[model samples]
Target: MISHMRRLLSLSTAMVMASTAIAAAEPSAELIAAAKAEGTLTTIALPHDWCGYGGVIEGFKAKYGLTINELNPDAGSGDEIEAIKANKDNKGDQAPDVIDVGLSFGPSAKADGLIQPYKVSTWDSIPDTAKDAEGYWYGDYYGVMAFEVNKDLVKESPKDWADLLKPEFANMVALAGDPRTANQAISGVFAAGLSGAGGDVAKSGEAGLAFFKELNAKGNFVPVIGKSAPLAQGTTPIILRWDYNALSDRDTLAGNPPVDVVIPETGVVAGVYVQAISAYAPHPNAAKLWMEYLYSDEGQLGWLKGYCHPIRFNDLAKNGKIPQDLLDKLPPAAAYEKAVFPTLEQQEAYKEVITKGWDTVVGANVQ
Candidate 1:
């Protein structure tokens, strides 16, 4: 009788879990109609070239007949937060309806009452570790840190963080953006710290900052934000950026300058970015619909085309939803088999360290 009761209880719990997932995922018909009526979504800090946002924006506009007003294509995570506070009361296109930011910023945004709760239709497909419990934010996609080199200017490709320090790479190294404000650059510092201090980002970010200080002093590091134009022009031949961005640049500039995308051997880091609805969204329903479309199978696959691994990658692969052509563009499965993801707490801790130390430690002026 006791065993039978235990089995019954287990089955009941499983059923409840499934029901909760379904409840969170299903949007009301009224909600869909209301979104279509609103027909616009304002966003900030989304660069079209980064993480396939160019295709995503075009696809979303075409699919729902909604106009997406994207502001500040080159802004950082910090800038997005500022925009939210600055335009909270403005009922205009300038006020953002949605935001996509580094995972570390999610908690702070929620705490500040800047973002609201809205679960996507594909909520269950996302990993529990990558989403807020109350649905305030959820990861969209991720990429690993990598060394992006312009082969035309760089005779030898850098295979690891250490290799970038060699004389051959002098005056060649640049970061995706400013570490103080940009998620990618902050993660780059963490990746370098892993190699500099033997995989200890929890307490050795200062060492990573020190490494950059040396890199700057040696004249190997350029004080410039990395972009495809700099790489193509040979101004910034080697960029330390996300793998997705590196791969995108390589494919985008196939023959002009020739690009080499290499995942660093020593300290590789995978960082996830999440999307959320603004608490003061002028087009709230449209914002919700936008999130739904992004998490849908179609949206995930669209991100895959740009080489970013969607948060639902494992789930999608298990369901056999990934297309072969897109899969062909990805690095070997082995390359990411042991990829490291620092916890949100860990990322927060490292952000504090980097933000506080960047000035006294490295301080490479990029004016």
Candidate 2:
């Protein structure tokens, strides 16, 4: 009787341990339930039209019945960081649950402890280069630099970086934002460096900065923010911005002045944007679910629809999941295939060079 009682007790303890292991390993259903209970998610800097967040967000809301409060639609990568840092102590809807920022910002945010590590179910599908090993941040989509022009205002569109330095583009060239704080402008300078350096641009190389300095000296670099308004009014006839932004402008202003987006013949550089959860997210489970949805096939396709290349495009293509019609609408894959992505360390170093040297090397500002 004593031996039987001991055996029963051992079995009971083993069962309890096994149950605990199962509970720990399988939390998806519980997470989903908890997320639904939360019922609300606050986000920052996601423009409805930019990168198809308009559709993506609506879809997410409908799918999960969650309320999404999108704050600061026109904010930049820096703004997103500020939002997270400012709201670290806020445990309400005012705090941002997730962030999407430039690749350079990812490492900085992770290092600053502003973001947390959480790998989704589809983590393995993301390329090793596009995500942190521990999942602090992961690349969502990327766009190449392009020249957006108002064809009606400028009869001649610049085809390459060197073309912008020509006499005709004087007082007409503009960047989306300041390089010191904007990834788009930094990428423009990087692309110019590649073109000026004979297709071998380094992250911290001076060739790009030199080209911009010349542009400033020539009075071709306008100190103005590049946006659809400036482009439409021809205040900044030529704007250096992301391909998606330029293309979106083309469609948005179809009958107006007719914007022309040109991929520079030389120095084509791609910039990746990463997504991460705020370290102090109020709805942690919902945030994780958001990450899961963003990485899933539906979310990736939503990005493609918005004209950005999803990080998991290759994986989706291999599985024959991408529709051919949708594939056809994308910019030639070869261009992006040949594109270069700076490593996190390289991006950080390059950002330091640009930010520190922008005032000294390229003082030109865009109004």
Clashes of each: 1, 6
Q: For residues 327-351, write the lDDT of model 2, one tens digit per residue.
A: 6776665545445566667677767
lDDT of 1 by residue, 77-182 (tens): 8788888999999979789888889999999999999999998877776777788999999999988999888988888898888887898888989998988888
Measured with C-alpha atoms, the lDDT of residue 237 in candidate 2 is: 90
Poorest 10 consecutive residues of model 2 by lDDT? Answer: 15-24
TM-score of each: 0.92, 0.88
Model 1: runs farther than 4 Å from truth?
1-27
* Regions more than 4 Å wrong, model 2: 1-27, 203-205, 365-367
Candidate 2 global lDDT: 0.79
Q: Which residue pairs in candidate 1 have backbone atoms (N, alpha carbon, C) closer than 3 angstroms, thus clashing?
A: 171-220
lDDT of each: 0.83, 0.79
